[model samples]
Target: MHQQGAQAYQQTANVVASSRERESALLMKAAAGLQKIKDEWPDSYDDLKPALTFNRKLWTIFAASVTREDSPLPHDVRENVANLCIFIMNQTREVLLEPRPEKLEVLVRLNRQIASGLRGM
Candidate 1:
């Protein structure tokens, strides 16, 4: 029954989620993951690398997509997204270097804010 319900939810999500919605979901998921690590602090320090890597990769893809020549986003919007993605990548690198709980704050906030914007919230 659980498996069936999970499948149903996946199907519904695939049908109803637009690109922006999907992006928002991914960002929120990333933010949640990072926040968990932050909340856990030293205990979750070992989880930091994997979380940061996931976020960095996500931002990299977003940067590439926005910067692509055929991207449908407006020039200024694309540029802005690309810039934000770059900052995310850099911040991820810093967190990786220091592994401080406080360093995770900006990443979490940015991801949540970006997700909210994507959802038009």
Candidate 2:
């Protein structure tokens, strides 16, 4: 029984690891696309554009908060749930624009895996 439990854990971890890579790639592309929109029309896109434009810092904070799915956040955290997926994609784009592509890629993967995992239920 113990070995079975351990195997299950290992398998779950492996699944998560692989999923992370897939998620990251999707996020990077989404984020970049959103950023391009914002850059092309700063006046047109609202501050909420996920492509890393006006509210990158704020978006990052929100993303990090959601990433901590188990944490207790401020009352306002729930307010941002309307476009969570879009935001994730935008965040991916934002992170990919950085000089350190490897690190950003990792983040994108993690976000993607999380998003994918939740879609089932």
Candidate 3:
């Protein structure tokens, strides 16, 4: 029975082999958008709300996916991801309240790092 279960898991894993890559790409895309806003500074200020909105929505989806009972990730990993999402939510709130360009650094860094990890880096 155990062997059969292990085999099933392996089969499913292969079926979703590109999920990690897709996740990584999405993260990178979000990071790049945020970075552009950061790099352009006051001139790009008009884009802040939209960029942040995109990132927040992306992270929210990730949070929901990780918390699902059907998620294949280990429990500890899911918990860690949830905690990170919480931090992201808090940081995003701070950015919205203060509206500082420098305040976006952490969000940009976290997104890139998470994306790298997803790529097995």
Candidate 4:
């Protein structure tokens, strides 16, 4: 019984580690996509729509996750994340409408910061 309990705990830990890794990867990917736009700037104005769309979708998923009743994050943390998501959504809309290279910096910074936070976790 003791060995079985140890095995179960190990399995649970592995699953959690795997989930965090995947989350980190996804955040990195989003940050990279934003960075590409930053690198190209006005020269890649055409890419803005798709990049912003992708980011919006990503934030939407995050908002949904954080808002869920089953979310494991502390209440204040969840609230803060949800608020950030709302801000991201609004900012994304502005970027979409204006499509300015300079405007993308905020998005890039936010994604990298979030990715860093995830990695820290």
Top TM-score model: 4
lDDT (tens digit, per residue) of candidate 4 on 36-75: 8878876877777887787888889889999999998899
lDDT of 2 by residue, 1-121 (tens): 9999999999997786665555445545544554445455545344323434423443455466555757454546444542564565565565545433333344444444544653432
Q: Give TM per candidate.
A: 0.84, 0.32, 0.86, 0.89
Flag the better candidate by lDDT, 1 or 2: 1
Residues 40-84, candidate 3: write the lDDT tens digits.
999999999999998999999999999999998899999999999
Total clashes in model 1, counting residue pairs 3 or more apart in sequence or in different chains:
0
Candidate 3 TM-score versus the reference: 0.86
The collision pairs in model 2 are 20-109, 23-112, 24-108, 24-109, 31-93, 32-93, 35-51
Selected candidate, larger lDDT, 3 vs 4: 3
- lDDT per residue as tens, model 1, 8-63: 99987666558779889999999999999999999998888988888888898999
Indicate the worst ten consecutive residues by lDDT in candidate 4: 19-28
Candidates in order have lDDT scores of 0.89, 0.50, 0.92, 0.83
Error of 3 at 29 (Å): 0.8
After the best TM-score superposition of candidate 2, give how far the Cα of residue 83 lies from its true spot, in angstroms.
5.0
In candidate 1, list every pair of residues with a backbone clash: none
In Å, residue 91's CA in model 1 sits off its true spot by 0.6
**Where does candidate 3 clash, by residue pair?**
none
Candidate 4 lDDT (Cα, 0 to 1): 0.83
